[model samples]
Target chain A: MSTLVLPDQQVRVENTTVRHVRPTRRLGASLRKTLYRSGAIIGFLLVWELVPQFVLEPASRVFLPPLHEVLQQLWKMIISGDLGTHIVASLGRSAIGFILAVIIGVPVGLVVAWFAKVGDFLNPLLEVFRNTAALALLPVFTLLLGIGELSKVSIVLYAAFFPVLLNTILGARSVDPLLIRAGKTLGLNNFEIFSKVVLPASVPIIFTGIRMAGTSAVLVLIAAEMIGAKAGLGYLITNSQASFLIPKMYAAILTVAVLGFVVNAALVALEQHFSRWARA
Target chain B: MSTIEIKNLTKKFLRSGANESTAVTAIESLDLRIEDGEFFTLVGPSGCGKSTLLDILAGLSTPSHGEVLVDGEPISGPSLERSVVFQQYALFPWLTAAANVLVGLESQARHGQGPNKADRRARAHEYLRLVGLEGVEDKYPHELSGGMRQRVAIARALAHEPKVLLMDEPFAALDAQTREQLQDLLLDIWKRTRTTIVFITHGIEEAVYLGQKVAVMSAKPGKITEIVDIELQDRQAVDDIRSTRQFGEYRHYLWTLLHRHGRQGEEATIDKTLITSGASA
Candidate 1:
């Protein structure tokens, strides 16, 4: 009888392919994905580098400059150290604004979700503000805070606030009732349940919101600088364009694009780090 | 001493809609006393309110009428003394298995011994080992299999060393083999700790296999139909108990009660069909 049970258990173990087979397949699939993404990026750059030289006239070349000329301008800016200072200033404002938005938005979202009557009262107001674009509020902010660093940072704050607020509310409200019940039964107090169960469960969605907010902050920073600034990539682009220095203008635009890309990539890395539990 | 005492308990759920509909009764005018240190199960068909009754005992929901007393004190809300394991393996998805267990221990320590971080982690390790998940403590919920996740949930619940363990269909999502293994593990834990347990399940065989007292409930506006006490010669493992003739008798008896409820459901369906067809004609 014991021998009978042994073979039956062995067969049962053999039948569960999830316990063994799928993990190996998942590794192969991720490798393929990395290769595919890198291949597409390399292909795009190659096309970008070669296309203008072969396809257009000399006078018309102003529309699409050669990759080497853009790189040369980029090199000059780096050597002069103007690019680094501008990048740092813009990054500082954006980071400060984004962090402030998160600090304010997360608690407001929690309160809204916790009290239904409060949510009902505030939701309409939130919706009205969220729909009103951050760029649209630029004039209002400039008038109130002046056309200084405060006004610029305020615009980024407005841009980043909504996604974080909305996503945190969504994440908090959608927690599993069963998990709450489990928490209650385990003798966890209201605070403990909120901290241990609700907060941790909401993390992945909240991190997604944070990543979106980070990207939006970078975007708003560029727009803010473009409107009125003496230094920064946006100032460089507008000033160069006025003087008819097309290569310098393109270099400024390139710097903005690269800054946005790097900030977004860092956010993605942070989200992945925090949301490892959500992978399952 | 009785672990839990319920007297004249009634609960109703209000329908939230345009008509201001009358409340739907869940459990009405009920009374039960679960003995200390016994593995008790409530078994019924869906809509029989077994889960609702468990919720009341766990203090997740307030009864519309009557009262529940745990060890002679009325249950106002959830307490650490009565730990619950849910069907959906409610392990914190953001934490590793060890961290999840540590969260439970930390909550317990808030009122009790206030264990430091190192002590809490050590205690979490002990409970994890008890559930036979020794080496996989660092793994997140997504990294582990379903069975492993459930084991982590069990470990988290047990880490607090609650006096009463409440489980609501904790093994319903698992395969037959995993369910059996978990059932055996549950029995071993219960035998060792002698904690009063209130388990709810729809499976008649499972209720009979695990519970010392099986409380069978009727469908809708649920009521306890009968409470049968299992009288076995020896306290045996689940596999050994299943092979016994007494287990078969208890299983058949529960099936008969459930069969009667099934017939009532069919009759209700037929009545609805006839009324709709007649109106259409």
Candidate 2:
């Protein structure tokens, strides 16, 4: 125990020796890293702000408003409480559709991948349906389900489902056969092998599919809303454009971008949480 | 009571898919007896079905003919009593070393190997310590070195207290120095546990050093040619017995036995690159 304690302490000291000697250098290095990481985004934003203000003609100003004007309109909508209502409507529809897709698609994928008979029967159908565009079915879904939340939500679910299902099947199927052999040697049954070995091993690939589905969910939801909806960011953008409130339309579009960014960030965080062991 | 009796055991792999005529014999009428609690080593030319034989003993693959019995009970599938340590350290990448050991313990719980869950965990730690991997139990396989990962694999194989341990070129991937170190470590553990071990390797040095009975095999229809009983002194003392003249004599004898094809003019060489490589399904 005494020997163990000394080695651990020595390791800790070795790890932090540079920091202890020159803490300012470490801080400066991190600051430089941050600057380098964000340099491109900062440049892009500056270009957006300056290009419309200086380069574009006055006639083009109505179509491509200045960034500050769009920001000001965004603030106006926030203070007036109109932005909150639209955001809630859009988020609710997207969230419900995405979550539903995940809840249904993942298990179906697991089942099909694990059992060969099921996979053989469903493979051709899936190939056809997944290839036939989700947006192509928009009019059909609207006509069948009516233009209520059902149609919009169903469209989002349809768009997201294939990615989650296909990726999960691929994930489950791609598990190292060596790992399964090891499990069998340890006396694991088929179910035990599936749960203990196959499921955990398939996580990284499955997460990749879910990330794709997450992007799909948001994009499909916005498209559905643009086609037919009383409220939501897509509806707001379309309505503002129709009313010739160009700045507000730009602001609503920015809000939609922010929402997509947040969903992606959340999905990435979840992926890291599950697969931290994979980090070298 | 873990005596393994292989009675006319044979395995064949079809060269082309769905072709019955071109079936190549991997193991042909292989008959051998491994006494209880003995360290057995098998050596052969590359592609001589040494790994295939190990897989069959572990109940991982079915023999085309005949049967393998452990204490007169024929095995049809994998059992908790027989644990296998593959050359590829097949630890679950997502699991820590401790969790991997725990998997083995849990598998053997039905056989009443470990008393309970808590005792099983303690045994897992004990086995890891036995393999000289005391502090890295919580580390994932990728975080450890190749030798360390193989140690975890050994710990997992032994943690369940199996009656027989099957190893297939377990140290073939390590560097020369690490390989020697693990060889010594394995000897020490085998001495203590007295578990029935069937080790397969292409290295003649490994076969001579660790095995009580080293069986030499021939390829093109894999079958045992000769069984050499090694008699050496002070194996438990840990002084390098490999340098001794008696060890050299056994090693040279096995080398000549493997190289007999040169005199016969059947094949030029035994595929030197495949000295440590094997094929499997």
Candidate 3:
């Protein structure tokens, strides 16, 4: 019995030691993650910069303009005031569209979720419309609203609306039954439960939807502008492309990418600030 | 005096399926009367529909048969008269501990005797202190320990100053040590506030320790099996009472009652598993 117990105790001691050593191993694992991520990004950038420098001739560079030329065109656009107007126009469209989506989508989502009968009736309708791509409606919008800012803005709204509405519905519907019970126990009415418990609990998911909608809004606006528009970043890119100014077209494209990135970053920051109570 | 009268409460959940499945009776013919300010507990095995009974009383779920009356008034829906602390720490994760409590107070103010924001905040702070979470008001639920989160849930429930408080295994998730600590805190709060509490738990020791009257319930289509009235002669602390002969007797009695229900639950679960496995196979 003593001999058997000695090996068992040794095994227990080894297990404890292994548990103690695990956290340091985790730290090393995290370090490896950071190293891998940075290495991949730096390697990609280096290859992108080097490919144009060494691999391509100057004549063929018209199709794939070097990073430097694109950067130079970008700088010129920034200095000149043409880029600013286009960027502002795109930003304004996305902002208005996203705001409209939230205003209409959130309340509608809440009402639909709260009333099961209404949700049952409307779900198929929403599913049908949501699946119908906003791009598909571009022709109709152009005919009805004309090829103006209204068509462009409305297109952005249509693109953004589905995500916000769908996410809000999902968020509202998925509120923890326990939380609702807890709300009821606290003597909260239906509306109080919705406003105080359900809405606040759904914020993180709803914000995710809003962020997705914001990105979609920008993407759709760009495509809409490219179809037919006098102003906006998409217009600048299409105009430059049509005129065969490859560098300037690339510059406009880069600006749109940067604008989308900034908007996403801003929304993420807002989500973090508002949902400070959520687990990181 | 805010007594609760639960009369012939029966709840049946409709099972949705192609076969038009039979209604699952959660609670059946359950009648209980909790005196105002009594520390009453409902103890049973899981699936005994103890929670369903509490839900009906809280007005979260309507009973298919009979009624729940608080001070002779029928419960229609959730009202501030009865507040509940759930088994799971249902502290709103999006709000800080204080803010969650504030939500309760704000709702109360909106419907009841309205108070200014300052007054509401003060009331929230007061309840937070009562739950021993005064310094951690700004902490989010995820940031707090399980014990602290449950305390915040309790604080939120109490902030509304409801006449009756319904608790459904609020300490079920806590470890034994933490559970005991919370149990004591609950007793202290109950003593100070004299809030009529109807606590639901499967823990016999816990039911025996805190309850002035422990009502044992039976499984599926649940009904009250037995009621044990606890007498604490010296008004001793929970720990002190645990060592007494009367406490041992009460514990033994509840344990025996709960054991019978536990065996029934085990048999039901085995049957269910076998049927499911059979279907799959």
In the order shown, the candidates' DockQ scores are: 0.41, 0.46, 0.31
Rank list by DockQ:
2, 1, 3
lDDT of 1 by residue, B86-178 (tens): 889987777788988887677767776646778888989988877777777887888777777887898888887888988999999998988
For residues B209-237, write the lDDT of model 3, one tens digit per residue: 88988999988768898787766542343
* Tens digit per residue, CA lDDT, model 3, A9-54: 2223322322345788989999999999899877866776778788
Q: Please identify model 3 stretches exceeding 4 Å from their true place.
A: A1-42, B112-117, B232-245, B261-281
lDDT of 2 by residue, B1-281 (tens): 29999999999987876645588999999999999999999999889889899989888899999999999999989877898898998999899999998997887786566669889889889888877777777888877777788888999998888899999999999988778768877877787788999999999999988999899988878999888777666464646778865666677778878888436754433342232222110
Residue-level error in angstroms, candidate 2, position B253: 1.0
DockQ-derived CAPRI band for the predicted complex in model 3: acceptable
Q: Which stretches of candidate 2 lie over 4 Å from their true place?
A: A1-23, B17-21, B110-113, B236-238, B262-281
- Candidate 1 per-residue lDDT, tens place, A1-280, comes to 1111112343334335654558889899999999998998878767766777887777877766877788798899899998898888888899999999999988988888878899999999999998998998888999999988999889989999999999899888998877777777766778877887888778888888999999999888888888888777777888888998888888889889888999899999999998877786
lDDT of 2 at B171: 97
Q: Compute the DockQ of candidate 1.
A: 0.41
What tens digits encode model 2's per-residue C-alpha lDDT throughout A111-152? 999998999999999999999989899999999999999998
Local error of candidate 2 at B185, Å?
1.2
Question: What's the TM for model 3?
Answer: 0.85
Compute the DockQ of candidate 2. Answer: 0.46
- lDDT winner: 2
